[model samples]
Target: MHSRLVAVAATAAIALMAPTGALAQDATPMASPVGESLFAELGLPELTITVTDEGIEIDRSDIEAGRYLVTLNNESAEPEVFAGFVQIPEDRTLEDLSYADEVAAGTPIPEEGPAEEDFLWLYETYIAGGPSTVTEAARQVVVNLPAGSYGVWDEDPTSPRLAAALTVTGDPGVRVEGPEPEAAVTIIEEGEGGVGFSFRLDGEFVAGPQVVKVLNASDQPHFVEVSQYPEEITVEQVMATFMFDPSSGATPSPDMLDYERAIFAGWAGTQSPGATQWVIVDVAPGQVLVDCFIPDPLAEFTPHAFEGMLQLFEVAES
Candidate 1:
């Protein structure tokens, strides 16, 4: 199933990138324009929602008005599922917001979780698959205000990470870019025995210059660091350097490794499902290790390498 999804996604991406003559005619219309003065017209401040591997983030401090439009952009290669509502401190809650269009008829009100009353159902769609230029408008429902800090997050118990924020009287023009890249590495799980990880040279074993893109597909935020060790370093020596730790209360000692002078590091402070980072480095015929570190406090105070989040590669003579 996972492989099928990947294949479909790749195909969709290819179709989207195809030239006008080679593209299909059944392509759906992209998202509509968000409107020139969305903030001024709606009496709401401009808002931006950034989806990352760590979670969702809202630029403004609060939501003060009854009506507003929120724009969400997916910067990752996977689809993002948004389901929940904006929370306010008052005794009332807003539950009439819509995505692309109003909520489906008879959609039940969410009765559980942080933003229960403000339940909204938005289907999962690939951000990369949408038209290069797409603008989506979401109807902002009115919620009685009590003047307090409120936040938005995935309502699904399975996904409890916060995605954005709303401040009653905070600045409205704030804009947040996606997370930064800290490191580049691959993760290899070895079942129950243990795991192994390493870096890549040109995405394969052959020597040459390569560009590596690191994606945080996990629920929490993560960081990446690339370091080069001596050329004589062995694979075992390289695995000892990468580390990982989770915020969910899990800690495990990472097996370190050695590398050369060239290193690329990608870090995600709070990587939500759709967060990603990338790095480019050149490698000659030698060995390298790519490491992913996640410090989770709940499960164990350990890095991803301890949990087997590492990928190793060897560059052969060209």
Candidate 2:
């Protein structure tokens, strides 16, 4: 009878050990080689995230069944406080994931625990303060999810630019579209001396006409304007007007110089960094001066003209 009892005890012990071993394997976190890095090539800063007292939530539904890292950066000179929690859709599947304030060598960020009202207060205060004081801050949230579309910013309508859509398609052949140009150029600054920009139109007094696109690769806002000079003029005359007083209002009378006119004048208005704008104009045969006029506010602190931000494109036969 004692031998029989020993056998039963041994069987129970083996069963307990089996479950413990399985649990240990399930608890281990898995890493992915094909996952996207938060800060790989695109130059940007780090960010922090938290839950606010107001219960503001961000929708995050599009992520593959793996791990992810969200990064936020402080673009302005002032310190900003962000309080909110990331919302995960019910239909999606996720795994062991965590959130952190600092990534690599960046500044350390703190996670504010679950609170909705407090988060709303913080957001309102920052928006009312404007870009001059509050500036723009970024946040990065990391998680593991199954494939779908995830919305990053939904709490504040005033902050649509912050909204990011994350799509997780399982196909390995899919590619992320790089930034492209919609217009020839954009004026980074406006007003007098700020930063005005212009583009060349390819139209002859009577010839082929086509619209070209210019793309803005910088982080500031920009626009484009078009102006035309006399069809029959020497290089010296063109140099005099561009190098000398452009706004002298000096006329090249019938005898002194040929008549020049501003045929098309359109601007791309203001474009945020990494954005594109399209400026269309009929091409004209002659020497065209594409000036990027900088508004006084932006030009007051920078020398964009001397630095060659202002370009002059020549359109001849063909």
**Candidate 1: Cα lDDT at 263:** 39
Candidate 1 structure quality by residue, lDDT tens digits, 36-90:
4223333433345554545655566545532233444444332422322333334
Q: Relative to the unseen true structure, what is the C-alpha lDDT of residue 108 in candidate 1, on a scale of 0 to 100?
A: 46
The Cα error of candidate 2 at residue 240, in Å, is 6.0
Worst lDDT run of 10 residues, candidate 1, spans 126-135
Model 1 spans > 4 angstroms off: 1-209, 232-235, 238-270, 316-318
Overall lDDT per candidate, in order of appearance: 0.32, 0.29
- Expressed as tens digits, the lDDT of each residue in 1-318 for candidate 2 is 111111121101111111111121111112112123322333322223223322223334343433333333333222332221222344421110111212223533223222222222221111100000011111322222234443333222222123334456564334323322232322333222334323333322222232233344443323333345445554345334334332556654333332223233212222223333232333456654443322222333232232234444555555
The candidate scoring highest on lDDT is: 1
TM-score of 2: 0.30
TM-score of each: 0.31, 0.30
